[model samples]
Target: MNEITERDLLDFALLTDFESFLKHSMLTLNPGMPFLPNWHIRAIAYQLERVRRGEINRLIINMPPRHLKSITVSVAFPAFVLGHDPRQRIFSISYGSELSLKHARDFRSIVESPWYARAFSQMRLSRSLDDEATTTLKGFRKATSVGGVLTGLGGNMIILDDPQKPVDAQSKVRRDSLNQWFSNTLVSRLDNKETGAIIVVTQRVHMDDLSGHLMGSSDQWEVLSLPAIAEVDEQVPIGDDEFHTRRAGTALHPEHESLETLRGLQKDLGSYDFGAQYQQAPIPEGGATVLRNWLCWYDRPPERTTKTKVLLSIDAASKDGPQNSYSAFSAWQVQDGHYYLLNMERGRYNFPQLRDKALALAQRYEPTLIVIEDASAGIALAQELRSMGRHRVKAVPVERDKETRLFIQTSKFEAGHVHFPKDAPFIPDLLAELLAFPHGKHDDQVDSMSQALAHKFSGYTLDNLH
Candidate 1:
């Protein structure tokens, strides 16, 4: 550490305000005052300095949850800025009054603290808390909860802190309302002057939140998005390695000396959550269907045997012609609730080609039954196959909504009741569908398979036709 000069101390003191002036005089002035200026805070301070210089219009910090973002932005940092420019107007808003009040209280505490008094001995504060959105400070108006349009001069400084609550963030309706508030109420208040807005928050919902709005704009905003889990898809590991790589490329790279030390953080926290919460990586959506941990679990296939009772389930697509859908055939063995998916055939085959394949499979397996979803051209295919001496063919229409069927199947999967061969042909597809169900990404194969399984297990065949 080098010797501290009076000029440096005075400049640092000036950045904060008269409160800072008094605090420096009291020998309590330091980087780690009320809150430590961590790397993120330091980076934010640099940006805030730009705000002071009129270089940038907005600075948005979109960090993950529980990362000291609120304390830095809403409380200590804001106080520090006010200490420097007493006339600076800041309008801070959150989703609810309680949250807004909480941040306001934090600001009040920092201002009222003994250290703050010692920092700025002559700093004056308004005793009356204005019920109105605008409060007069030294003849300058500082607005609170004022809509963007209301700020006619544009916001000299606006702090949008955690605009969406955890619940509201997830609720589509509530999210839309909050987004509307930002677009209509908050943003409309900005004046032509260099309006400084610093947004610090943990993302609870989709990217289209406040941060999402600022994504493309370059002149008015700068976004710092750090998700809990960073995996884009199946190919990349979105956890620790990727996290360090991002940090290394950032301005804060020099602050962290060793990646190993960062990795050691796992000792204090569990890997699963640590990877997500701190690393800003996404966790695989796991719930009732297949256990998240059991996604990789499966039973090894038994040796091929002629004695096993085999059957095939066909989920036929539209016969109105090949509109890009395939005639999916899944071969399985029925034993209790578990159906071991064996072979799968999926392609855009014509009526004759599909008929021949279905017959070939029936003969090859010597199936105890051949269940098929009776819709589109499935009825015709079944009739034609039967006329060709394939009496095992049965047409089964779906009974209820696909969602309802998935719920039943998923319940079975969660209970560890569903069994499948280790070498199951469509196991990957099956698991993917199982996990992706209700999410509505890939349910076609599962929909077909469900129709066949419902018919086979429920003992409702074509013979039960009434």
Candidate 2:
């Protein structure tokens, strides 16, 4: 009778599930180093299983850096798939050829190891045919750089790992080139469209990055988005049988990444890089135009004997089109050289809806001055409100561009004259837009706030106050 060894039991377990295979292979690859299993790793295993089973054709995963994303998706998963069927043709690419080739070597090492051979005895890699980045059993596994030529080569599975580096993410040329290559070249290199799978795994760099472009365009991809810190209570999938319930403000993986470590990372990386790489939002830090860490947070406005002048500033949007600018309304109570932001509302609304929201805010805040930017929709809304004669509505024309207006009000924020509510739900969105000023996708909030500050500080408006 043949001897039944520990290796035999381990091999059987690995073949049973991808998760088991991943854990076992990781141990084999990195001897003596303990495998720290986290929810993200489990989630990745589940997604990889879906890809293996042909349940999902396209998959995009966005997570923070140094989260073992590359190991799980680009390296081990490809090796695991090939272990099942060595004939499978896998094509992997990264921002550079060196990185892609490095991962390819790692995958090749895993498949060629004695443990892997024991687990998958039938699959064999021919030394004569295989190189550092390419493996040939029946078909072949190839790896290349993002812009590298794949003239006649195609793949059963295509893995794109960090197509653009963090520094290159801001370049329009680089971003456009990546998007074009993906759309024109990389996508067309699938061997069998009906059964082939494509996986994109990277941290969000910009609102128009490859991940963003894919997500915005179609619902074809199954996206597994994981931010460093939990923003809200959510039920996150780990594996088919396991699930992780994440609470707001909780660390993604407390064992590997504690709250203190993340906070230190935030301080080290700055707001832009931290938000983009860690939080996966890609909102850059406020520049010279708008100083970072400017606004002070307050639970309530300072108590004063003098009357508080509540002012409602409106920056209206002309149309309710999907891509059109949003209508922003900011209610500020000016008291003793400080502007306390009482409330803020922003949304995409048509003429009637805009009018209704303005009227509602006016009634709720009971503002002494309702300043509306004298633009297309603003002009109409101001006139309608003035005709009602319930509140004082002032229609002020925006003579300067958004940047100029924002620049004028930057001093107020720098001087710590602007304050925001401590626990407001809109605080994150407002701060993100402010911090990413001139670069972020939305600017309506900044425009409205600037107008409010400009109107408040202007000598003429102060002297002519009702």
Candidate 3:
């Protein structure tokens, strides 16, 4: 029997543990600096495990730039995979030849280091291999650009990092070319028909980018979307059995980039670029759907004496199931031909909760009229509120669809009439829904705003108040 040395045990740990390999290999790349593992790094480690186990064949990861996406996916993962199985073929693709070659060199450096050699002594680069853009350690690893020719290359695992350059993402011609190469050329280079794995890591650049196209066209791929800041509560799967839930407003990497710094960057980038680059939303900010310049921000409402009328507008949810829509309500103070948005409350609730919320708002605001859309639960809510005789509730029959109503209100927003409080916690939610408009996931906020606008323009006077 042969005895294993201390070096062999250290090598065994590196081969079996992905995170440990990543931390130890950091010095080879960035010599004296510390390697900090963020939440996203831990999450990426879990995903790589799934790939190694063959649990997921096709995976897509979306995250903002400068978040160590390339380091984790293109550099560390390939080295770790190749360490365990020296003969495993890895093909990495990127936006340009230079970037692709850099990754190849980095991977080679990690694997050729003394530390890695001790751990995986069996894995060695072939003597005849060229250490350039297309390095081949005798079928062990290779890297190439997106559109590069691959006449006789095949890979057991493929990693595509930032396939689209941000500047050219909007060009239809460039986007189509990349998509074609991926579908036709890349998919055929997989060594195995049933078990080969492919991973895509990129920040969303357009609605027609590769990530968007794949997610829209098919459901075969498992997607892991990590936005720079948490826009929604998400339980992101780190590994097969572990998950991390990021609450809304939480930064993905707070130590590296503070929440305050990220918020400043968002403001500087504006809504359009920020949505695509940071939020993983490709839609332009305040485009044809909504006017960005028309959004007016106020420190507070006008003087108490300047307020002539107070009203509440409700858009109720139709069902009470788990998938039930949210019931949204907007409180407004109308004065001087302008509607000052005072408060907005939106949530998924049953009849009892909805009644209690509406009653509570009425008690606090003392609104003269409560405008409710006469549809589904709206009718019942309005009737019940009126039956209490505490507030005047008017059921307005909505003649047009939500889109039409929003379009009508677009002119008001364009004219800079609709105003919102600047520092409210609900401001971001309201803006996200308003800017995304008809394409957004939730329209309850839009419907409630439209209802309020409909009442403002209805020519109802103070004398006619019930």
Candidate 4:
């Protein structure tokens, strides 16, 4: 391939009229848009195309604020999707009717624009249906003003556009209502076939706020996170050192002028708030029962070398072999004021599979005491483990609420006592749910941890004493 001349590049940039129209329309809304596509937008487009081809059913885009993310994904992108598939059903929702209507209007404007006419001459915007929001000749239908109007629709592309506003997103009641609306109303409207749902919003609140509820789910959900500051190493699961380094570098880089200004605006707001808004991290207070600063201050435990007394806690699944509960088996070595979270087994599993794992943990870690929560439908499985000659198999009952237990353990984690492996697979969910206390679901890991820790920290020595 020959190297294209600067003149040719510039000409091509201009000659790409349809692309220019798209860029110009976007510029009209956000003039200072970044030169390149952010990761979240790219991911959304990729998923949207896949859905158009009937690849995936659902997706969730949870990004930090002030990145011009919503306009790219929610407002303008729907029209773009319609360009590809005219018959697609699109429904967009926001916190309030007014905001939802505004997004719908934006979509209508794009479809009704002169540029739209010039680019796609045959296409025409459809009249608004009383039940349906709006439709276009491209066979794409869109609706913005919705609160509880998602019943009876099928094959609809549900766009939950910031269902919780900044203020409402922070409120537990408001978050619960929106989640309920999505579940009871919006999600119910989909046909028997796989439905497409897109949740695009700035990270205004907790992980469990809305996006967190959908984690580890196979019902067609993917979280597309884009932080304003690009981390140093730029890996998939970016680490702290590289994250901070890259964030600082992005703030100082001259080409990223607007991002630097955004950083300054964040500084004006406050660092923790900035972290929540722009870093795609969870809100410190919104469903965050445990303080992240305190958690970050604590360090991971040193790898075990010599023989150590260990307590293993298991939270078993209740229903399906794969879709039921996540079977998490965590081992803790309570010595020298350190709680080492040794191994974790989390995924869909049956009794036989879970039994095999229990045996494996016993053989591998040789735990002194085994604590399995005698909750959920698999209580008899605990007895089966004991019947199999698993030494020190203790089935402990978890009677306390998750919040109370988490509150008890939060103090320990803050005191630099609870240590988890940096690579523990369940660590992310554990930390996320622990911080996002009452609101987050699947408190199994935290519950098991709290039970084991409560047992240890309270100076209880008898195995299976609870």
TM-score of 1: 0.46
lDDT of 2: 0.81
What tens-digit string does per-residue lDDT give for candidate 4 at 1-466?
9988875654454333223434645765556964543333344455555555566656666666544555666776666666555666676666667766666666666767665655444456567552244445435455544475555556566777666656666677877776677677777665553455554454645555677666633455655565555422233322212232223225322344466586565656544555555655654573366666565322555556654568888878786442245677777777766677776556556677888877888888888888788877448767787776756666767767778877877777778777666544345446655665665445667676777787653445444343
**How would you encode candidate 2's per-residue C-alpha lDDT over 102-149 as one tens digit per residue?**
787778778878888878887777642232344456656677888888
lDDT of 4 at 279: 55
How well does each candidate superpose onto the true structure, as a TM-score? 0.46, 0.67, 0.79, 0.52
Give model 3's TM-score versus the native structure: 0.79
- 1 or 4, greater by lDDT: 4
Q: Clashing residue pairs in candidate 3, if any?
A: 11-119, 272-285
Which residue pairs in candidate 4 have backbone atoms (N, alpha carbon, C) closer than 3 angstroms, thus clashing?
86-138, 86-139, 86-140, 87-139
- How do these models rank on TM-score, best leading? 3, 2, 4, 1
Candidate 1, residue 376: how far the Cα is off, in Å: 46
Quote the positional error of residue 9 for candidate 2 in Å: 2.6
